[model samples]
Target: MSNSVKTINPATGKVIREFETISDQQLQDKIEKTHEAFLDWKQRSFDERGALIRKVGDLLVENQDRLSKLITEEMGKPINQAPGELQLCQGICHYSADNAASFLADEERDLPGGRALVSHQPIGVIFGIQPWNFPFYQVIRYTIANLMAGNTVLLKHAPNVWGCAEALEDIFREAGMPENVFNVLYIQEDQASQVTEHKRVRGVTFTGSAATGRKIAAAAGEHLKKTVLELGSNDAFLVLEDADIDKAVDACVTGRINNNGQTCVAAKRFVVVDAVYEQFRDAYLAKMKQVEFGDPSDENTQLGPIAREDLRDNLHAQVKESIEKGATCLTGGEVPDREGYFYPVTVLENVTPGMPAYDGELFGPVASLIRAKDEADAIRIANDSVYGLGGGIFSEDEKRAERLARDHFDTGMVSINGYYIAQPNLPFGGVKDSGYGREHGGFGMREFVNSKSLMIAQ
Candidate 1:
């Protein structure tokens, strides 16, 4: 093992652990072993695999405290949020185990000339590159589904949360998963291309920025391996004339500030119709002002430090530049003098097209508010971006909001009168630059599987 990945305590800016990354030969060996493992694992009945998957879910719930603590310490997620992330990950296990068999079962069809069957078969080892935010859920979101489909997985998690990565791998092993069925590669980002190009690696899935996603997808495409990319998004939360201001504000605030506002699908843009823009603005500003930043380990802390100093600086730079380009800082723009990487909860108004806050993802505890002349303007403004991951529509008339969200909103996922990012039973991913392919629900289990047509009658 060569010293490479350094896990840091984001809350204290201290080194927690340094993992020795494996050599190229060792990585190749693991990929080969995972492929070998897949051969046997795929032969097991769905009931057999489902039973083991259920046990893994039970273990996750059973060890929630320790696992959640690891996430909170490694990445500065407020301790209160960590348990929910774990619970969501555990839900993925349960959902995948319960649904994979039916989702992937062979379909018997009647044809004009002969009978045919469609079978979902395992496609060897898939390589996953996950992000730092929502450490446990990010990995489990795709991994558990792939595993349930009988394809082994190799995870290349974010650098700052190495401990969470190892702990996840260990948990699966402890649950009696086959050796090398799920492995963690403590490799550098640069080394990822090699894994994609490896002959034994069947597919690759990544969750990160568009620039990085382009590179990974390119490498995987060159190898003719299937790829799933879940990149960043600047999702908009729209408040129409008839929206319930109190409820919308609460949901948008949670979407913006939760997990210290580092989520890929967090509601970054707030587009409100002119009729109630002022009312929404006042309430939203008041709530954001009340967010307290402190040690994430404290249960009462609503906001925690950004995962790293560089990330905090990047977020600040985006806010500063937006200010320079005519955006007004409504509140919480100034950087406070503090020990950890703490940035104030900022809200930028009068956000125009050219401003960074309007055109791009903030990726931190910053919100952008854009006023629209009417309902038409609100929908127009919401769709004006390169990203289309997730968005929300808040209105008292649920039917109208649902219709607009279904017909007009150009994003991959939308919530009516609320905010949501991940659900075990829903398909998760995005369109355009936000990345392609769907995960969760039944879609993820078949992402890397071989759907072959089995003809029966002569």
Candidate 2:
């Protein structure tokens, strides 16, 4: 494979930096160094690692704006959202630092033969394959938790966000972290599999498309290595007959258009009861139209360009195909002839299955509105998909809302009267093709380690 890493600006499609990619020998060296560091680092007290992670959090706050700007330049996330992402990263670091020690504390277990205990141990060097959509938070969510649990990390980040990857490495170094505690390998597409197959890489943690996740999982499985996969989602937003139209519309707008509608948990399918279908559609489209799209660096910009031109083109094609297939364009669907990778926030009513927008993950500012007859129909429509990452329900009837949110089929998370929020205290993941394995909270921290059982006789 070619040993060249080209950093492209998604907003303008310009090459910002061309980095010399790490050669196969260099990757092997990094794995060896990380493995060596893990031996000593894993033996250190949890308090030591926790203290360093806390320091890293402090560094994040000190440089939040600078880092946020870097993300905007690299991936075109709205300036407002960029700072929030930085803050989220800082919060995760702090949370991991404060709670990982207790989470990893050995637990006494009762067994038939003798007294036993379950202990968490570092699994050596972890290989993290993160995406560019959430350049900083995605990496931090995996890196902070893994490192806090006594494991070192080797990151192979997406090509578009190479600068963000290097910035993360610099943050650790600036926080006085030892070399090899966190190593960012500048990788070419062809070298990804080889890096994951390295002997020193004990496990893999990946966040990307389902196709890529399958390949990584297969590689890890072949080596008998542990892996955590966080894949894509075609989340549903079900609005019941009793739901408040005003609230439902507001929440749907935020859920669909946040990050220019590039989020995995963003509501892609809108299933509304026929009783208030028109009311909800009108309100939702009004709010979507009000969203301001401009340069990500603009503080007032609520929606920015889709991260890449290819994504924008794919989204445009999906919207066009949906319209051609009898879906009504309730609001924005056409791309303005602009310099940046910008597509208008699009809303489609009467979007049925078999259309491109209905069948696939629309990773842009596009939403589909489908009307259901009753509660049962709504539930059925929401679950009529292969991707089941998350879903949302809005209703005035509290009991009905709870039942729908809790009993939804195939979703990892469900929200009532609100959008999906991935907190450090919660277990975040998905089921079905949305991918398996959880991240965040205790589940996330433990993903990089092994739970070893020890038995002792009296």
lDDT of 1 by residue, 331-410 (tens): 98877886778888999999999988999889888999999999999999999999999999999999999899999999
TM-score of 1: 0.98
For residues 1-458, write the lDDT of model 2, one tens digit per residue.
55677776666777888788877888788889999999999898878888888888888878988998888888888888887787787788888888888899999999886899999998889899999989988899888888988889989898888999999899999988988999998877777788778788888999989999999899899998888988888788989888888888888888988877888889889999888888888888888888868877889888888888888888898899989999999878888886878888888888899997777899988989999998889999888988888889998888878877786555899888888668888888998888888888878878777899999987
Instruction: Give the TM-score of each candidate.
Output: 0.98, 0.97
Error (Å) of candidate 1 at residue 10 is: 1.6
RMSD over all Cα atoms, model 2 = 1.4
In model 2, the clashing pairs are: none
If candidate 1 were superposed on the true structure by all CA atoms, what would the RMSD be?
1.2
Q: Top TM-score: which candidate number?
A: 1
Clashing pairs in 1: none
